[model samples]
Target: MDFDLTPPTEEMEKFRQEVRTWLEENIAEEMKESLDADEFTEEKYWYWREKHKELARKGWLNPTYPKEYGGGGLTGAHEAVIVQEMRRARACPNLSNRRPPETIMVWGTEEQKQKFLAPLLTAQMTCWQKLTEPSSGSDLASYQSTAVRDGDDWVLNGSNVFISGRGPGPAGGPDYLFGPMLTDPQAPRHRNLGYFAIPVRGPGVEIRSMNLIVGRDSHFVFLNDVRVPGDHLIGGDHQGWQVLSTQLEQEHGGDGGGGQALAPDQSVENLITYARQTKINGRSLGSDPLVEQSTEEAYIDSHIDKLFSKRAYWIHESGSQLAHEGGLSHLSDKVCGIRNANRVRDVMGPYGLLGIKDHLAPHGGTQEIQLRRAIALSHLAGSLNIAKVVLARRMGISRTQERAAPMRTSGAKAAH
Candidate 1:
């Protein structure tokens, strides 16, 4: 389908065609086969990783971001065309490229940008975020992890949990997992945070793969007294919070609107495909009235979320700084996670009630994993309660009002 794209410059279009041709020609046959088998071995994954860098080296992945920083420096319209083509091809975007550097480039110093953005854009090194402590979850500001300054180094001590895809997704690929951290202790709780572009592998950094309820192993990373140079500090020392908020704003939706990055949509599509194919009794699962209703609800929720998110993205792309509603982006992200959990749970049902593999009873497999994953979603993404809190706060309803009105119970109660 031809999308109403922002027309690319003639040169950009020429570059696009060249890229499409190159991907068709050079993306390895073995990697394609591995992706088909859902076998993301390090070797097969590296094939795709190399391809991402090749594109990056050519300035095709994030064109219009900035030429100096290894972005193509194209307009948003041009980016739309790139995204549309990648989607149409059923090929992944350069997932390894997007968020962290974009966050850094926007808020990092010229030195910070020079240090991280160029290498990131050129695919020289990979970075992962270190936020969300064991204690902090979605109340990220309350993080117990501290980056106290020690001479020219910042001694880091904390653990970040439920970080995603340290290896790859269903299809083999490199992980793009980078984040902001708390840097300045002297600043206020919200204001003292700082962002860092840390690699997945570092001397003091350790990532342990977690087998999720679903089939994948995301990671849990522990940073123990890791020493990062002061120059690696993004957006200055105490200004960490300033940089951190900008990154969170981007993560919640886009810079301005409520759009998320890639994974959420892919997850929804996966569930929808399952609904279309999986059957109960004689009828296709997609045909059953209840299934259809769930399907419609899922679709509606996904589209509404996407629309709001895209709107948010454009607002940010246009240099706007405010969410239309104060915490709408966070609320939208919360909705996306909950909807994903609910949609998958409704379709999968009692089987999903079974928890993780290690705890699986005699009759266990998909259901156990699904159920556990569904439960974990509430915690892994923003907690269900956090979403309500954001939504309540944004709507200008006091906590007392919320308690009195008695909104739906959160995942905490549902888990029981």
Candidate 2:
């Protein structure tokens, strides 16, 4: 409920100005144009690589991570400024910038951090989470991947589906998986899970791109007796579940998901601009009462989404861990995703239905892609239903109490 501004430090304000200057000079027009391009051609890949390397060299890619490990070590406020600048420039984040190495940092050994964190954070390499197998979607505890101990090494064998990976942002194909393999069949349900740093290109590893409803591919990686050194195993032989939580934190937590997605201000600005220019029935959409009303509604929805997200971000930053309530962050995420979809469908209408590749439709800047991104984000990121379960447990309410309370009508009497 508190609305007082969390003032940025003088250092952060200066950093913002520096980032703005660099973005003005470095963000290429070609990269911006490719936002509407269909194919992830080779040239597009180069642009993505160049941008990532540019940011890496400038120490801007890993903002808010440890500075010693190739991160910017910037505060949350500075990160917000950087995200705002990127959205304003209409330059999408380099694909590497969105990878899942931070999870490794939290759960991996000091040696693991030294080996993978720097390259992953610096955008020198890309990583993906390979937890979701073909047979297991949400029930990860039941995964059948087996890693057997042999001398100082472990042999991994299993297949993971729906790995969200790309080589680079604009140019990269969805061709990779990132995470460790703990494929020990003999170990207990949770204990057998072992994390391995399997490279996507090794002899026993194979990745195939499976396109989704939204057009982007989710990699299906099959691991066949891949040999991994003892050092490559994350946090030892049976600590996979512990490390898994850390990775999940990155996916569900604030920074990774919060600032990167479509911002309210940016969405509102684009919607308003399209409304002003789009025409229907010989009248400018901006001037039409219905169109104007829809536009305002979209703005309001976006505003609510952003406001709740900002509140959650600040809450996390203010040294409080899950202080607001359990599942508050997840609730905000669902709201934001639904609100974004509504805004896109209502504001863009026929144009919104068209994919990013369609050049003939007006406002062809990946808005449709952005909408589907929200939906996928809502579903895959975490189950909203699971979130409610967590919240119910946190609030000390039994499942029956919570479910029954919602169904009670005014005329219904409670039984003792």
Top model by TM-score, which number? 2
Estimate the TM-score for candidate 2.
0.81
Expressed as tens digits, the lDDT of each residue in 153-235 for candidate 1 is 77777787666652554322233345556666566786777666554445777777656554454567777878877776666
lDDT of each: 0.57, 0.62
TM-score of each: 0.72, 0.81
Estimate, for each residue in 9-47, the C-alpha lDDT of model 2 and write its tens digit: 797778778888888888777666355333555665667
Worst 10 residues of 2 by lDDT: 403-412
